[model samples]
Each structure stands twice: as structure tokens, then as C-alpha cells.
Target: MSTESHNAENTGSNDSVVETSNLAGSGDFLIVCEHASNYIPPAYKNLGLDETVLKSHVAWDPGALAVAQALSKALDAPLVEQKLSRLIYDCNRPPEAENAMPAQSEIFTIPGNCNLSQADRDVRTKTVYFPFREALATCLDHLQARGKSPVVITVHSFTPVYKGVKRDVEIGFLHDQDDIFAKELIKTFAAETDKFVLRLNEPYGPADGVTHTLTEHALPRNLRNVMLEIRNDLISDQESQQDMATILAQAILQAEKTLGKHKNHTAPTTKPIKTGN
Candidate 1:
């Protein structure tokens, strides 16, 4: 079942935290992992779910965070991650989106997030969503100010089979309207192996009008961006996660080549800017 909204209450959780390397310099890429962790702060007591459930996809991307960490180390890039469960408040989703405050996520029921009032939602937006996004925008601005055009790569992982259906593709690129980055990445995967079939906008899409951070923030800067989805089964272990991270790192390197080919073409910018909390 899809969770459409979440109710909130007073909690002793810090809305945002920035995890980074001490090596501070402009890196060519800036990575963003919207559902980085499944951590429900000590105060929330796992948000009324089984502690084992905390480790499940309902609370976090099963293997995506590991892939992101491997990619960050391999690429020497700064990664901006959401510290809490997406169930608490999805960093990728717009504040007003239905799933922005999910009543439930995956198989878990969010006891703290059922039948929320508008005021509760507003507090969540202020305390959780805004702060992380604001940090992202500020980081982007700082990098740009330093003359670094960071290529935004969002890493996420999906369950291998949902509702008992098997998936064939190992990786997918999620995007909307602008296919510049997605198309190039597809070509890279195609050339790499027949076993590797990259799906364009498969698994997820931005067409339904749910706001995602990449489309909202990075796209406006004319910054090259793409959302990557890896099947959870492929990266369920450390070895596999590293392997995919290497694959993605190479693909992004190839995408840089393709972007150079289309220097004359660029997506037009849009204007509804919101301050990240």
C-alpha cells in the first residue's frame, strides 16, 4: 500500500545534519542521497515499528546509502544526506506532495504519522524538510561561488520485486522533461554489456507532479543532474554495492564526455525557488 500523508507531533529530533569529509575543496560532483538512512532518533523509539523494520526498506533504501558512501569515496565528492527516515519527512518530495508525509511506508505503519493536522505538517516541513534542503542549496551556492559546477547525482535503490513481480533491469535513470543526462547514461550502459539495460524514467518519474529535489534545485542552475535507481538485490551486500558504485562512477565519467558534446544545448531554467529549512 502507498502511504500518502503523515501526522507529526513534538519530538526531540534535530531536523538536519551534514556528513562530510574533512578534505574541503570543490569536487567535480556533488552527490545527494534523499533516503540515506532508516534511523529514527532515540526519542521516537523506532517510530513504533520493529527495530528490524528500521533496517528494512520502509525505513531506508536497503543498499542505496552504502552505494552512495562508496561512490563518494571513489569519486572524492561531497555527499548531502537526509539523516532521518523518509517516512518522517521525505527529503526528495515537495512539502505539499501526498507522500511528503506518508501515513505509512512500505510494510510499516507509522503510528506517529496518521491523521495529521495542517499545523503538524507545517512543523515537519519546518523542522525536517527545510533544513536539509537549505543546506543543499547553500552548498550548491558555495560550490558555484568557488567556480565549481557540481554534477548532481542522486542515488536510490528499489526492491528487486514488489508484490512478487521480478524486475529485469539492474539500473534505471529517473528524470523528467530533460533527458540529456539520462540518454547519455543509457548509451554507456548499453555499450558496457547486453546484461546491462538502462531504463529511462523507469521505476519512477517526475511527470506525476510530485516535486523531487533534483528537478527543483539542481535543474534550475542548469547543472547536469540525474536520479539513479539500482535494484536492491544487486546492492544488498558490501561487494555488490561497491561494484555498482564503480559502475555508476564510470558511467558518470562517460556522461561528462557526452555533456561536452552538447555544450551548445542546455535546459531552460525555472523560477519557483524555496529556501531549504
Candidate 2:
């Protein structure tokens, strides 16, 4: 699903910059993976990074696409994903975001992103950002046109250790302005007999500008949304990815029932979920 397209006019779901699939799935949910690929298109000269850095989480969320695809299949929901390295254009970020094309990520310096003019940024906005946004919007519009309001779910993965600091949070549930969906999700994980370090807004939160996708799509449409940030080490293989997706899918489906209470837009209390054993 590595995509490469330079034309801003290529805004369709079939566009090379983004990928949209599982359209035949139900409307209960719409899943998106913004940092799905690590492809640099052989152009940017690997963003002036080494092979290892390009393959690192700084380039993309390792094993996130697998989990997202599994969720899409399990929920029978449509999924959208960006197909280029985040170093080229972070689909989850707004065009004005500084890290949208970060010159440095963690400790690795992105030489390719350094010293970019406004024109260079504009080119990437048109080529990468627009296509991903349009694709997700198209999915939402399709569901809306069918008179179906689906909960928007975004999938992502974080490095186990970041900038030399070890992260104890195994899984993080983030919300935009809405906390109804997030509350139930965290509750489900906490209620489960199995132990997992699932918490609310750890490592990165809406305050860190990581909820841009949810704000842009779900908030405007008034859809229930939550972003899942899993530890990449937990999903390094197909078996682990599927296993994690199954547990998450069960929790997500069960949590959807709580949405009924919030139809009146009643904001409930957000109780913290204990994590990090």
C-alpha cells in the first residue's frame, strides 16, 4: 500500500497517496491508520536518514497497519490509511503542524526535512496531506449519505522507548474534545481479567497536538472517536497483531453500547484507568 502521487488533483479514494478499503463493511465503525507506511518513494533520499532510521517508528508506526486491518475485518468497517513515510508528510498532522514534516524526530535528525521553504512544504501538503484527508472524508461522507453514523477509530503505535526514556504505558486511549467514547474504552480494558497497561492519554494526548485527525473528521461530524496508541513491541508479528486486535475489537464493540447514554451530548466523568504494573 505504498503510494506515490504528486498531483493535488488526485483526491479520490483510488489516489496513490492514500488507500481506502473494506468499503463493503458495516457502518458501525470507520477505522483509520495515519502512519501506516514507511515508504519514502526513493525520492527524498531517505529523508537523509539511514536504513534503520527510515524503518523506525519515526518513519511510521510499526505493525499499526496490521492491527488496523484486523480491526477493519473484525468490525466489518471501512479503513483508510496514508501510504507514505511520516517524514514526508504526517497524515495525522494538520498542514500548519511543525511536526507535519519534522526536521527531527526523537533523537534522529531528518536532514531531508531540514531547511524547507514554504513552497516545499506546500508541495507535500498537496501531494500527501490532501489525499489522505480527502480519502477519510470520502469514507465519512459515504457513511453519512447512507444515514449511518459510525464511531471513528484511529489506530497507531508508539515506540516502547522514546528519546532514551522508557514508556511504561503499554496502550494509550486518547480522545479529542469528546470523552464519552474514551471513557467506555478505558473502562472495558480495566474490567477485563487479562492485564494490560491501558490508560487514558499517556505518552501523547490531545494537548500534544496528536488528536488532529479526530478533531478534523470525528468532531466536525459529531462522531464518537478514540485513538489507540499501542506499544510497537506488542505487535511486531502477525500473530501478536491479530491477538491484540481481537482483544481490542471486543473492547471496542462492547464500549459502543455506552454511546446511547451520550446521545443527548451529556458529558460523563472520566475516571482514570490504572496502568503500568
Candidate 3:
């Protein structure tokens, strides 16, 4: 479903409506971003935090949504994104996980999420989280039904400083017990002319048991997929975002050539799927 109007507060002139939109493409790829916004609707009232806390990483990944938007336009792929704060309901995490509704994200207390009962959690999950995920699944299904099983690429951005230490790796790939797509993409990216010093999984890895939407949908179908994490500093603005998109787009094209097409139903006879770092 196309989201026309967004009642979110003004963060900047570039801020656009944060809802799921499908930019249908003839290419064999589908892109999505689960934690796309830091916007808290008027109803929530800043999650009862001070200005500093509201602007923290707890509110959202600093620049992920921007990268996803640029990548979607560059690659002409269908894009899906969440409309609320990850602290409200982490679309990337399983609903039952303890950290799903974190009381403290890194170092900020989510005062608005102090003690949510099962019913309270259920309300947000049913209302916001499920719809966002459904939108992604629907878009993928639409393509698959048309004899095109698109490669899934989940985009995200990470903070440069997590408590004071600086994170140098500009890109990371996260995958659970599977690395068919992640490994190939990482290798392809490293060897490209761009020569991205991509991290295998520097910031975070799938073994953290942080169940992302990619794991929920793409992996089960055995579809080629990868979770990309770029350092937030690299995508804090349009110029940076576009550069990252170009770098990623090249890597994706290389993966398509090396891994082969998605049309063939047979599974690849590669090395056993291993968990990425």
C-alpha cells in the first residue's frame, strides 16, 4: 500500500513520509529496510525523553532509511520500510525477544517503553509491525507469482560511535546459519574497483539471536539474501547515501553474475552455509 501522507514531526526539509512503498522493477531483486525511522508520532510525545535522548541511536539507526531510499531509486527495486521507532517495536527482532522492546538502547532509557504488558506489546505488533512486514512479503510474492523470484537485499545503517569507541568498517553483512549470499557479496565487494574494505560482520552478527525480517521470510524460502549494514556517518546525507548506493549496486551486479540467476529452481552446490562474523 502506498503511504501518501505522514503526520510525523519535522526533523528536516528532506524528511519524507516513512511508510512502505513499492517501486516495481523488472530486475530480479527486492530491497527492504526494517528500522527506517526515528520519528515518534505526536501521540507518543517523545517517548517521555529529553531532546538529547530522543535524538539518540535508540530513536533509530542514524542514517539507514536514507541509504535504502537512494538504493531503491538507483536500482529500481521495490522498497519497504517501517514507519515508527524501533524502540516502539523492533521490526528486525522477534516479538518475543527480551531486547525487542528495549528499556535501554545502548545508553538511553526508553521511558515510554518501561513496562509493557503482553497486551500492550500485542497492540503495537498487530498494528504497526505486522503491516510493514506484510507489505514486503506481498511485494515479493507479487514478483514471484510473475515467474520472477527476486534476490532479497535488506539495507541498514549503523552508528560510527557506540559508547565512545569508533567503528571503522563502512559495511557489514549479517546472516544466521547461512552465508551463501552474504559471503559472495562480501568477497565481490572487496575485489571491486571501489575496493570497499567491507566488514564480514564487524558491528553485529546474526548469532546474537537478533531475528531480522530477512530471516523471518527470505531464508525459509531458500532465496538468495543478504543484510547490509553501512556506517551511519557514510550515509548521513544525500551525497553520502548515493555513493554508498553506487558501491552496493556494483557489488550486487557482481553477485548476480557469479551466483547465477534466481530462475533455476535447483539449490547451489556451494560450501556448507556458515554463520558470518
Q: How many backbone clashes does candidate 1 have?
A: 9
- What are the per-residue Cα lDDT tens digits for candidate 1 across 170-260? 6888665466777788787666666665687766666634338777777778777778888898898889889888877887777777677
Runs with alpha carbons beyond 4 Å of true place in candidate 1:
1-26, 208-211, 261-265, 268-277
lDDT of model 3 at residue 259? 81
Tens digit of per-residue lDDT, candidate 3, span 29-133? 888777777776666678788877667676777777777777677677777787677877777887787677777788677888888889878876665666666
lDDT per residue for candidate 2 within 36-117, as digits (tens), equals 9888765567877889888889899999999999999899899888888888889889999999999989998899999999
Residue pairs with backbone atoms closer than 3 Å in model 2 (clashes): none
Model 1 scores worst on lDDT over the 10 consecutive residues at 1-10
Task: Pick the TM-score winner.
Answer: 2
lDDT of 2 at 166: 94
> For candidate 2, what's the RMSD?
4.2
RMSD of 3: 4.3
Candidate 1: C-alpha lDDT: 0.71
lDDT-better candidate, 1 vs 2:
2
lDDT of each: 0.71, 0.82, 0.71
Q: Give lDDT: candidate 2, residue 67.
A: 100
Off by over 4 Å in 3: 1-18, 193-196, 265-277
Q: What TM-score does each of the candidates earn?
A: 0.85, 0.89, 0.86
lDDT of 2: 0.82
